[model samples]
Target chain A: MDHRQEDQFEYQLKSALHRQEPPNGFTVRVLARLEPARPEPWPQPWLHLPSLRWALACALGIAVFAGGWMFQQERRRAEGEAARQQVMLALRITGAKMQLAEARVRHLSER
Target chain B: MKRTLLSVSIVVAAAICAPAQTIKVPESWDKLAAKADDVVNVSLDKKMLQFASKFMEEDENEKHLVSKLNGIYVHSLEFKNEGEFTESDVDPIRTQLQGPEWIHIVDVHNKTERENVVIYLKMVNNQSLGMAILVEEPKELTFVHLDGPISPGDLSDLSGSFGIPKNLHVSEKETSKPKAEIKK
Candidate 1:
């Protein structure tokens, strides 16, 4: 095409794509679209009460402590019983040997 | 400095003054244990006796005797064959009882049956400190040491209750028999 025709086409394109004012509330609409909607926090009404929270924590602590104490007590009792059996056996042996010694003396003296 | 010195002196004195109650078993005895068919070893110190006494509910006499004892040690070995151990194995135990404080209370040897039983009592100022019994049979050897203030009379009462031979129930009269040989 000739230079005159090219210049006419360029003027038409510029007028057609000229900058203009944005529609009203365009910024607010874009911001709202980009931003995330915040959800509500989990409902913990019991945790919000200080006394109930403290009570639950204390009960858990006490259960753990009492279980440990009972285990220790049972262990000690078992050990004590074993030791008792040994003591009895020792005494029984001593007594039996003493009896034999005494019997020997008695038998010899009768002769 | 003076307080520390006093404390040290008191501890040293207590250590020296404490009666030697526990009999030292010879390490050589371990060799016999390896050959034995059955072994019975019981070693209970003062703390163990105290702990065990709490559970001695079956018999009051046992509870009383156990409470008074500081320690009890027994080592018995049974052999499958005759003469698995010799007199030399027992000499170490006998030597320990030969200390000045220990008095040989009973020594009965049956030559015919090849059985020997010896009893020794540790006495200090007429107070019984402890007792030791050594019994040797054809296939078994038993050694018993009872620490604390216990006399033969205390053990005599224990018979017939704790699986001890019922015949061991010696009355005071029988225990005092002239032939029974009660050494003061």
Candidate 2:
């Protein structure tokens, strides 16, 4: 067929396929269909909550407190041990001097 | 006259009942320790003594005295040369100890060696309450005072680590890292 006749035929076919007036609620229906799925925001606001933050903070605080308590106990234990050693050493010397003094007294007595 | 005598007797009896005075160690002795080459200035009060008793092993002789000790004062000063300390330095301490509640237990004199050891005990009601030992050597001066109930027999038996003698050689001990060497 001729170019003019073909153009006229294509226009008539497009017009026949196109809607003259949209159906009732056609815009609303199309818009609703076009609307993306809400997907419930991935994580439910209840599932990943503020309470979880509080729980994490409490756990970290407990761990820190326990570590500090253990450190303090260890330091006190070390101090007590050092004091013990000093006392024992001092006592030993005292005993030795006592023995020497006694020996000297015996020597004098013998003389 | 009888009443006056009775009143005086009551007062004297009351004075004897009074608790013994705390031995006042001169601050000069403490200062001397600060100046010495090495000093063992341990003064454990009642609470500290109780704490120290926990570290001590279960020995009858040691426990007998260790449990009774209310205080421990040790001031030992070592010098680089002979005649570092004089009689005048220790005379004041000797004088203080000469007062009431004290008795000379033993005195050892070795003039040739320049080593003299004097031991004194504080007595109350025939029971020993405390002890003091003064060792005056040419090179060192040591003063050890243990306050509380003690027995001479028990003290003589006391030594280091059960039965180990504390006679560690001075030169070897000075080379040792941490152990205390009893310098005679």
Q: What is the TM-score of chain A alone in each candidate?
A: 0.53, 0.51
lDDT (10s digit) by residue, model 1, range A1-111: 899999999999999999987999999988897677645556577688999889989999999999999999998888777777777677767767777887786677688
Best by TM-score: 1
Kindly give the stretch of ten consecutive residues in candidate 2 chain B with the minimal lDDT sum. Answer: B1-10
Best by DockQ: 1
Q: Runs in model 2 with CA error above 4 Å?
A: A1-47, A109-111, B1-21, B27-35, B57-64, B156-184
Report how closely model 2 matches the true complex, as a DockQ value. Answer: 0.12
Query: Which prediction has the highest lDDT against the true structure?
Result: 1
Every candidate's fraction of true contacts kept comes to 0.67, 0.31
TM-score of chain B of 1: 0.77
Q: What is the interface RMSD of each candidate, in Å?
A: 6.4, 9.5
Per-candidate TM-scores read 0.70, 0.63
Q: How close is chain A of candidate 1 to the true chain A, as a TM-score?
A: 0.53
Residues B1-184, candidate 2: write the lDDT tens digits: 0000011222232245442336655566656555566555555665555665666666655655666787666667776678667787788888888766677655666887788887777777667788788998877788888888864644545645432244422232222223222223
Q: Please report how far candidate 2 places residue A69 from its true position, in Å.
A: 1.8
